[model samples]
Target chain A: MSARTLLRVLPPVVLLALLAYLPYLSFSVPGVLPGRVNGPGSMQLLATCLVFAGFALSYDVVFGRTGLLSFGHALFIAAGSYLLTVSLADWSMPLPLAVLVALGGTTLLALVVGAVALRVGGIAFAMVTLAFAQAASIIVLRDPAGVTGGEEGKALARDAVPELLVGVANAPYRYWLALGFLVVALVLVRLLVRSRAGHAMAAVRENESRAAVLGLSVYRVKLLALVVGSFLGGLGGVVHALVLGGSGPHLTTAEFTLSLLVMVVLGGAGSTWGAVVGGFLYHYADARLTEASGSGVLDALPGVLQSVLAQPLFVLGAFFVVVVYFAPSGLTGLGGRLVRKGVRT
Target chain B: MSDLVLVLVTGLGLGALYFLAASGLSLVYGLMGVLNFAHGSFMTAGAYAAWLTMDALPGSMAVGLRLLVAAVVAVLVGAAVGVLAEAVLIRPLYRHHIQQVLVTVGLSLASVAAVQGIWGSDPHPVAKPALLAGTVEVLGARLPVDRFLYLAVALALYGGLLALLERTRLGLVIRAGVENRTMVQALGIDVRRTFTVVFGLGGAVAALAGVLYSQYAGTVSPLQGGSLLIYAFIVVVIGGMGSLTGTAVAAMAVGLVQQLANYYAASGIGDLSVVLLLALVLLLRPSSLKGAAA
Candidate 1:
């Protein structure tokens, strides 16, 4: 193809190739990774990050693309995880069938919630979705019929999972599975954004009245984005369950959904790579900050200061505020600006 | 019959608490199109401030006198924090509604985490005065005396707020600002100053709610404000965002529904029933909530 197209294509291919080859690497980044790059601990952390990156992208479909500020996205993700686990352990369903059931269930949930929430536009829609998510969170915490395990969380049934994906020794396989998930999520989001409905969503986000005047069905477009985004979020939840070996009530919280919003905003909303990078960086920093909290550097500080630094959310939240003030478009947008300045120079 | 009275009185007490928490939030949202997610953090800070004040007081001092001082300190701290948040974090991002909400979200997360870090996540048992801890007989039902205090305080706040809105010039500006901020601004009124005042007012009231809530629960924790915040949010939405009267009415309904449901049906069913109430409200009258959009 042309030089411009080649340049655009080259970076992602190289990045993907590097990620695919990460399992064979033996190098360790002492403070960053828990072990060698290929080791189970690092692999598990990386895999989790990838799953979140995909999760954040799913959220972007609504918040970033369609400008729909939903506070209940966590419900779908939790649904994917809890459903798959419950199906495997309780219903004795096969692994493949369980995954399908989880995805299907999440889609149905999105449809119902989206339809109800979209009844009132603007901030009202956000409140409605939040109420639904809160309801789900309460149900999960209650753990009725002894299914959810309440605060303790539900562990994956080893008998249901394949031998190749079951143990710590097989971390590389799970890592690969997570990478595949991210790829599929990326491709699907790319396709959707380029579709006719995607255009409608964009139009609706810009001006609802104008878009409606232009003969675009605003409600349908919004519902489409919610369903697709939630469906992908469910897929992330399934992968998250596999990577973590369980489903916790943490996934069903309003805070979890807020963090997704933070990630998308931090990475640069409405951009494919921005959401992914935001999610990956956010999860990585959260993990590493906890590790760093115990490191000697922070220990040397006074008691109160040390305690403040120890909390990952405190640091991330402060950083997010700074980002919102100084870098409104997020890291990618900032990077784009610097790149443009460099080219001009 | 006694149980019903207990439940009803307790529910009203709880509703009073919700009203206190939601009033500031509703006013802020009504006037300034910002959802103020950090409103809970304001409450938490106020609670902690009061707790710290009480803990620092001399043991020989009368507990009742110390609590009064603590309440005063909490209200001041809350108002100061509210004003600072408005001036520093919110004022700069004028007209950027989404960013304002996002900043508040970040502030809430950070503030709560900071509190957890400094104090640890464990709940601190609050020192209640003898009068507050004791039970009083009402219609053959012995109820905690704190419920009555909550009701009294809430009624007073409600009355004060109504008078302020109905009589004061600042109240007139706030009311007009909520209806058409641009036109008010066009009239050469510095609506921004009013935003700060409303935030300060919200903070002070929310702080009072925090202190009262800690007394009700007999403990103060970092997450206390957040948990109460969800119900407050539900109250705000159900009451119709920005309408003080609506918030007061909705708060009572939610509080009564929750207490009655928990007592009559199941423990967690009350929380679920409140959510159902929100859904039912949305389905029945979507236009009521449409006023929230600036």
Candidate 2:
């Protein structure tokens, strides 16, 4: 490849390499980075972070790039997880087939949901999506089918997953599987954003009426984005289920949706790479704060401070409020400004 | 016939709670074009305030008097939180729905965390006042006295709010502002002040709902507000975004559907039915609902 091409390829190549070997690095560096790298305890958190990175990137495709603010994004992720879990646990399907079924089912779901949601634009669309998601969550919790395991959630038996992807005993392998999915997600989203359809999505987002006036099928563009974005979201769910060995009703909560929103917003909405960065930062911070709160390190502090630290959601909320108010464009926007200033200097 | 009466009355009772929860949300949406997701948090806050007040009061006081005092405290606390939230959290992001959603969601999460911090994750039981704890016979059926009280209070609130919006100078200004904020601002009125009041009132209303509903259900959990927020959103959507009357009607309808679905179908079908109804309505008649704000 030419130097220009090499330069273009270098970042993703480096990222892939780092992610692919993260478990090994962590395992080898027990002294430098104790719990997080030395064992399954922290590697499990990293695995989840990888899954969420894919999910957040998919969300960025709609919210960041297409300017479609969807409140029901969790439904896609949960659908993928739940479908895969049920197929494996109930029907005794192979892992590969279960994964295939999940992706296809979620894509169709996105298409149907998108068709209904896209009929209305803006805030109405958001509300419609939220209502659908709420309904789905209620169904999951109700679990009339006796399959979802209701509030306790459904977990995979060791035999249900591929031996390589089973958690704990083969934690590093699970991490690699999650990392591979993230790579697939990144490549897919990058390609989508650079394609002709991607340009169409941008045009529609910029101004729906104008795009419609100019002969762009606004509905089709939106539906296409939703379909592709949700497929990626489902893939994230598959990774979530595979790495964690289970799925739960918690996957469908509005709080979960907000967390995804925070991840995208904290990273910068329209930037694909920003979503990945934001996802890693968010999950890492969340895990660290949760660990700190439970670690009893704050016991020496004042009672009120101890109470505040003990509840990690409060910290996450405070972080979100600060980010939206002071850094609306998120870290990516901040990075962009600094680069621009450097060029000017 | 008694079963029908029971269903209708029970659903209306639930509708009354829905009205109390959603009216403030609808008003804020009308006035500011922002959906306050943290509205439920305010409700939870109100419930906690009432709980605390009742806990602190002298045990020998009359139940009715104690109830009134607790409600006042709850409303006051809710209003204070509202003012503080509006000033600090919501003031900067006016007219941006997406930003408003993001911030309020954050606020909601923060509020949930705060609630969990203060109250812990356990559910607290709100004992109904002695007078409202009795059962009453209506049309050959037994019903709790508190349900009747909730309906009466909800109706009175609905009527009072209507009069305030239709008959009072402030209400007229609020209505006019919702219709055209820039034009109202150009007329030399401090629209910002009106919004602050609206935000605070919205908080008070949601708090009242929280207090009363917790008393009605006999339990208040830290995370209850998050789930209730969903039902409120459904009411707002079904009734038309900004229409108080529409909201009332929609709430009743949802209440009826929920009660009936619970009776006739599987345990969780009620929520599913409401959402499906919303989808069908949106699909079939997106523009027919008259109270769309934007």
Candidate 3:
């Protein structure tokens, strides 16, 4: 590759490598870090972070690249989780087979949801997707038949997962699988965004009317993006189920959708690497913040102040508001600006 | 037959609550073009406001009279908060839909946290004023008087709103504003101030609904507003954006469907059916029920 191309690819390649080895690295040098870091626990955290990275990147393809703000994106993820878990729990399907079925089911669902949602653009499209998501979540919660496991959620059958990928002893194996999933997601999304179809998606995002005027099939480009995005999102959910051993109704909530949106937006929308970075940072901060809030660090503070600090959701909400207002482009955007300014100087 | 009547009445009661919650949302979206996600938080605030009012007042007053006082206080407080929210959070971000969505959703999250911090996570029981707590015989069927009261208020508000829009000058300005904000602004009216009033009115109306529903249900919870927000959005979606009559009609339809669905299906099916209805409507009419907002 040329110097320019190598430079462009270097950051994400490095990020992927770092994320893949984060758990082992953090565990090996435990005392070097300020906080407590149990070996297996850190491995699980890295695995969880990789799953969300995939999910956030999938969302960015549609929302950031295609300019489609869908509130029901979680529907695809939740569908994957439910489909995989149910197949594993009920039929004791092999893990790989279950993943394939889930990926297929979610892609088809994306087609149906996209067909309905893409009829209207902008805010209306968002509302429609949200409605669908709400309905889907309710169905999962109600579990009309015995399929979804209702509110309790279905778990992966012990026999379904390979013994090598099952317990705390298998944390490293799970981490590697999760890392593999993230790498696949990142590489595919990067390749897609650099292609002609990606250009068409960017065109639609920039100006749908103009794209239509230019004889480009705006709807088709959008639907294609949605399908790809949903497919990757479903893949992420499968990884989540694998890493966590189960999934719950909360995965389908509007809150979950909003959190994904926050991740993409915070990492810098429209940038593939931004999604990965944002996903990792957000998941890490969320896990750490939840821990910090309950820790003895806040005991000396006043009651109200301490309580506010203790509630991580409140902090996350405040962070979201601040990020949107001040740094609309997100951390990656900030980095880009700094780099450009440095070159100018 | 009696069971059907009871279900219908229950539907109407729920519809009234939906209407009260949705009317302001429709008004704000119509005039300002901002979907206030914090609209439910306003309702929650109103419920708390009512609770505060009731707790502060003397216990010797008649139950009906006390509730009346509480409702008035809640409306005033709700309107104040609405105006404050518009002026602070919403005013700066007008015409920026994505930012508006983010800020409002954030505001709602913060509001929920604040409420939890203040009231704790536990649901608080709000006793129905003794007078309306009892049931009255209507056509030889005993029904909670409060249900009729809720229905009556919703109808009265709906009628009053219709009259305001059709017969009053302010309504004419608002309608014109919705149709073409620039043209209305060219006519030299302070459209911005008008928006402030519409927002406050919406907030006040939502609060009133919150307070009334809380009393009827005999409970108030901080998280109740979050769920109600979805129902209100569905109502606004099914009812064409910027159409008051459409909002009223859609709200009632949703309320009735929810009640009937719950009666027939499993526990959570009522909510699902409402969502399915929204999706169905969006599919059938891509823009809205009446193709009002482009």
Model-by-model lDDT, in order?
0.93, 0.85, 0.84
The B-chain TM-score of model 3 reads 0.95
Question: Candidate 1 chain A, which ten residues in sequence have the lowest lDDT sum?
Answer: A120-129
Per-candidate RMSD, Å: 1.3, 1.9, 2.4
Supply candidate 1's per-residue lDDT for A219.
88
- Per-candidate fnat, comma-separated: 0.74, 0.71, 0.53
Error of 1 at A340 (Å): 0.9
Clashing pairs in 2: none
Q: Model 3, range A56-80, lDDT digits (tens) per residue?
A: 9999998999999898899999999
Q: Which candidate tops DockQ?
A: 1
lDDT of 2: 0.85
| Better-scoring candidate (lDDT), 1 or 2 | 1
lDDT of 2 by residue, B62-145 (tens): 767877899999999999988888888888888667888889988898879877886788998776678788878888877777
The DockQ scores of all candidates, in the order shown, are 0.81, 0.70, 0.59
- Once superposed on the true structure, which residue ranges of model 3 sit more than 4 Å away at CA? A26-38, B265-267, B287-294
Who wins the TM-score comparison? 1
Each candidate structure's TM-score, on Cα atoms with residue i matched to residue i, is: 0.98, 0.96, 0.94
Summing lDDT over every window of 10 consecutive residues in candidate 3 chain A, give the lowest-scoring window. Answer: A29-38
lDDT value, residue A162 of candidate 2 = 63
